[model samples]
Target: MTAAVAQSLSSLLQRTTIEDHEAVLKSCNAVLAKSKSDTRAQHVKAVALLKLDRYEDCLRVFEDAGDALKQSAGLEYAYALYKCGKPEDAITIVSQLGAGRGAQHLEAQAAYRAERFHRTAEIYEDLREEHVSMSNEENDLRINSWAADAQLQWKGQSDSVHHTKATRDDLEAFETAFNAACLSLAKGEFGQAEILLTRAKELCRTSEDLTAEDKEAELVPILVQQLYVLNKQGKQAEAQALLEEISISNISDLSTKKITQNNVILTQQTSPNPYVLYKALNASPTPVDNDKLFEFQNNILVGNTHTADLLVRKYDGIIRSTSKALSQSPCPSVSPSVNLLAVYNAAAHAQGQTGALALKAICPLLERRPKDLGLALTAVQLYASTGNTTAAIHTLEAFLRGLEESISEDDKDARFNPGLLSVLVSLYKREGRTAHIRSELAKAAAHWRDRSEPCISLLQAAGTSLLHSSDRADLEMAGTLFRSLHQRQADDLFATAGYVASQAVINYASIENQVDQLPSVSDLVADVDVDALEQTGILPSPGSVAAAAAVIAGARGKRPAAPGDEKSAKRVRKSRLPKEYDPAKTPDPERWLPLRDRSTYRPKGRKGKQRAADRMQGGVVSEKVEEVATTVKSSGGGGGGGQKKKKKGKR
Candidate 1:
């Protein structure tokens, strides 16, 4: 292919990303159309195909491009093989490309896939100094992941050679200490690693016969480790001393190395620093080391009055120190500017300047990193703390809107972070701007209905906040929000509980208002017709009308007058008992009747008449008396002492 076609194809490829696989393929095909025999065009086509995930077609394209272009297209070809499930072949292909960054990355990936972690580490280490630089945050993240994996696999395998090498010279000592420190750092033993690296520095300093070249070569690694440790230990002055010692020629190189190491720490997502300096200072008035105080004064943190007090007491002027740090970095980078703003704001606030003064100082930094959530949140907080709540809210709103607008239409559903939304909602609630909060929350909730956890949590927090608000309308809105949340996520305990609580509050409020408006008991009962109410089912029917009547009558505290009770009524009115009344006397003649014969009625049968007759005679007849009489007669010969005796007996 001619230079023009090659340039066109290269320009096209430059504009393509993983998200535009079709565009890549189209551009590559257009190049291939003009240069059917061009191996470069064929290679581009294969790469585009690979990115498009047409693995078999990609491999075929590579094969058709012939073995001559394999050296040039090795990474793409190997990547295709890996995608096609031939990792061993991919590994072999990548290994044959000598010392290139792409080859090293590809080989590391292949080795990683093949579980050859040691080989992966070796490849990454080879790429560490040459083609790889740490300025690229994404690349840094990738390297850290690969390195962490390698470190995990190589854990507990500390070679004896490394120990022996540490005794040799400064560079050797530094390397040994760095390696051990890296491992120790990986395991979270910061103190032990600090001790080792500090010793490594001492060894470098006391080396007897080292040449200038050796010293220069060893200086960086020792400096890097020392600086990292000092930063970790919050020893900024010592770190500054080490920084001052670095030659300007090596500053870029040292920064790259530091970023690389810092990336490793970041991938663990742990803030390994002892304390967020500002937070520690804010929490107490305790004095920190000069190094830490320097960091705070230089705007690396939002220092408190405590830090200012310490700085004033020690160095005599914190504001002057911070301004000096700012002047030192005139063409300020993002990181330095962030620190500068933080310290400037903190110092100004300490001196009793309005929050607006501090905020104005950092407005440039805010504009530069509009999408930086941390910086944006910090600015919002500073604005809020200084009583400029409206400004804080507007800043957060702009930040969140920028984040939304920056997302591609394809990723708009998935990519939104809820943290900004949460901060904004919190600000709104703080300012009592509840009306804006719900609408913003609804938009966020709908956008993050399925993907983002932070958004969901924000909605939950907003709903809970609304539920507890003093306004009844806000509380009702809370029930609606939580009900929607519960419908979407039925198992969310907070949403479910919030919804229930809101409903309870609403019901209680309604009932309380009704209670205040209700009439007194007499007035209420006067309007009600009891018979009509029971018939209409508004009132329940009594289970026993007579018992209900009696209970009601007794509860009235007055006896109804009856014709027969006139005498008793007169006695009751007099508050005295009748003269003839006796406490223990029976009221009627039958009141003392025997238990077995109280009633005149008898159970029917022959026994009934007999029982009645016995009761009438006041005696009980027994069957045994009749049986004895009959037996005696029978024993005397049955018929009156015999028939002859019968006549005598009769007489």
Candidate 2:
């Protein structure tokens, strides 16, 4: 604690600034053991330990110095805390440092590590504002801004990447191109991703700004992404070849091993393995011919439609395609394999024809497999998708006639929840067929009213559908259903909304004495939290809840319309709907479906364009890979994080 001892400790720290870290650490420890009360000695020891990259041991030294070290040794202490997995602690220290890019950058990294992606993005955005209005740029500010945008996209938010225009030479900038490639891959634009990755590869090899050590950090990641894009494009052979060339030391982002395993599975193993050579007979437990279905599904995921069509033919052979397989399937004993459904659906979707027009593609299948629910449901889906609701309902009703229940607990093959039935209920709700729900589906609806999550979600969907009904009794019916569902689970978002909406409508119509039912709703508004509803992109904000309540209160003060004040129409009102067409004469599709699907029909112009955009919005992923595909590993901070230079390791 004396002047001489503190001066000696400062001299020991000076050795750390040179290449004498180990010697300084040894000397500082010796000095601190003798001068246990000297905070200056503790500071010197922390410096030497940090310089030696011993972050864990450095923490003990800093703990002794504590607040005394905050002013002078804050940067190194915070960096050490971040390196030692104390990012939140590092964030607090960074905040105390006040105003500097280094502190802000450290906090950004800490927030990213905490998985606070939105906060990480905000910090990067603040750093990038000066660069926003320019184009053809290759600076850290712009690059980190795009990187942060990619992180947000991975977190399932809409991407707000500030894409500066890229000149041709800009493609050779490895960092920019690499990030752009990830954005493309996430968007399901494999061809564009591949192009950007190729540019990234060229720049990794030749960028003059990089030194020998830096190239290694960037090489493996680019190659790994390339192998993935190639696999998605159905170039299995090329993906296998590229995967052989990639030698990662500690990488885990790309599913390199899984992709390689799939390639190995499909490489004509007929003699060694017969799984790929035959159509699976079993529908459950495991897909008997999973390898083929996996490959087929992968093709469908990337919209390699032509390849998927070829795969369907290759899977079942041309004669044993979906129609033929269903024809041979033993009805009621078991359904035709799901492999055929995938094959036929892909073939049908590629043609842009569903329902009966799609029937030309597989009419014989329906005739042959009359008892197969899978094929029947496929037909119903096609009918529904193409506005052939009349056909869908007719087909579904006839299919349900022989079955005793919508879900059979005794039959393993029978459904537990209603995907197939919900479609029907949806159709019924649309056509204002309250009798169909009341008289026909009452038992089935009661059966599924409390079964599982899927059942609950569909019931909510049904309630929402009825809430939009033109009939006042239907609104009351919807309100009753939603009230029961909300009471069961107060946190159920759609259930709560439906109950509040119904109460709002019913209260609006009631006289003052009937307003006692409003308190339950008032309590619900105070307690329920459905903020997640805003992210669905389907539901409007519940700001409408307050608006509806306000309107209802205002309406209570007004006089009701009398018979004399209710004027009759001077001219007969024309129907706002499209003129109904005859199905027998014009091949019109809507007559068979419940009215809702028909009402959604838009003439194929701007509606078609918007639908296409929505499909491609968050990137169209098929079901299976969606469970498996990971986004590009995000690193924190703006582009100033030193470029990871990956050398092409010994091939």
Candidate 3:
């Protein structure tokens, strides 16, 4: 080798050893400048790029260096894929690197991202058996094992995640508690979950190695998980108060931002309006996309219409490639393009990108799968997302009408997909088509026959909507629906609330209608049959019945109360004086006041501290401070004594 290349190789070794990635990059570049085929230079340069977190650049260098990227760089490659949200690809890459501590850890991490919770647990288990001693890695393995179990859903073996926690190093401890908290939360031990998350936050805050950015990145997720626990515990005030301590503005890192957003949505706070909660969440965000949709969304966000249009066609190619395979898959949710649609729609909304932008992606697939309810709903969402609600509603209605006539058994169940029905119902509601909602929900209620949760929910919704009507028939129907729902699901507060409201409306209407049928004051004497009342025992006796005719005749002394008089009773002004009050004598001071407001009312409420001297009701005289306290208490004097009955001063 030449002297210059030799010097460069020496410098690269020195810099690489000390982990000065930038310096290592320069030294590697120096060697590669002198001899283009220097493999060491290429490898060191790639390592520098990976260490700097220039993943794309590192990948490019890996491509150029071939096998020189080595095991660690291969691990970095998998991590880069994981970060890019291609967990399956990450797992594939990690699997290709054979097995070891790093490879197994990488595979487990990738599996976690892919939501292969069981696989993650298995990998952690293997690692645990091999290590056999306490270390940071062991803590991490234990934490992640529990974390994976948390998401194993029905397959989870145990709920004793809280007992698994043990002392660990700062970052390892934070991660442990954070993961354990997830298991706790999954088990519905929200109080325990909250404690774990708080512990995680403390570790993050006190971590010596982490920078402010790092602390914030770790701390925000802990706070967000804590917020979720608070919500689950119904401590809404504490959740809102918790929001104040988070500073999303300081979180410039996209991964952290994504974490925050995920937690915010997962928490499911009451408000549907994300913008109102944007700052409060410290995480409320427009859904972000990976490279596929990001290219299109970024173009739209920056007003690059021409590029966005060109990029929009990319979805067409993706649809053409994946739609057939994905349609055959059992789970529609796993469709890549369909899954990305939400992120695409959200990104477009944030930029106010209103148009039929979904046409490129949805049109071809929709045309091919015209009768597919999932596809049809996706099409509707596409139109709706692009600010074409009218088109969306029309599209949905046509699909529903067709499915209503289809001969296939699957079609029958497909039409009843709760999400599909919900979208249609919500669409109709938005358009203010009360009749449509009533018809649709009524059909769904009959179809499910209260055998399903969706049926019960739709029934309650239908009942609530019908309860708004003033018609007696509608009110009665609503009451019936609510009554049935209350019977079927007694614990459903919403159903119970709806039943109460509907019953109230029905009862009120009945009372009002009865009042409406009653005779008016002018017709009261003509309408009364005194002899009939006497025979029916409604009158006092036969003599009274004979007198009843005369009784009702002059019964209107000045004004007589008739049917529905209570409704109009407000027209009468009550006199403060009693009927026998003499004008010469003054009236009782509190006669005009309400019974509760009268001075004679002695309110019983929470007790306050009483002095020892005051506790002695015999009015014991005291000395010094006790005497002063007594004097002060007496000065305030008694209350509720009808304005302290005082003799009028002589004029």
Backbone clash pairs for candidate 1 read 237-291, 299-339, 299-343
TM-score of 2: 0.41
Q: What are the per-residue Cα lDDT tens digits for candidate 3 across 395-457? A: 888877777787865666666655577888888877788887777766665566555444455
Q: Mind giving the per-residue lDDT tens digits that candidate 1 earns over 1-651?
A: 476876677666666564676876787777777766667667767877876779889988888778866778888889888767676899899778767666666777676556465666666655664554546533443334434342553342332112222233322444455556655554556687687677766666767767776777676665665566667777666666666655534433433343323322322323534344323334422222211122212232233333534434422355466546554642212343444444443444335444677567566666975644445666777788888888888887786676567545532442244544567767877878877876676566556555533345666766766665678877777777777777776666667667767777567663343343335579869978887765443424555764455445545665544457645443343347567777597665665686556675455789777667655764767787578778787778455644454335554
- Best-to-worst order by TM-score is 3, 2, 1
**Candidate 1 residue spans exceeding 4 A from truth:** 1-67, 71-219, 231-382, 398-416, 429-445, 449-651
Which candidate leads in TM-score?
3
443-529: candidate 2 lDDT, tens digit per residue: 444556655532455566567767766677767767777867877776666676677676676675532432443455668687655
Q: What ranges in model 2 sit over 4 Å off? A: 1-3, 9-20, 23-27, 30-34, 37-41, 44-48, 70-72, 130-138, 164-172, 209-213, 248-651
Better of 2 and 3 by TM-score: 3
Displacement of residue 458 (Cα, Å) in model 2 is: 19
Candidate 1 residue 400 C-alpha distance from true site, Å: 5.0
Best of the two (1, 3) by lDDT: 3
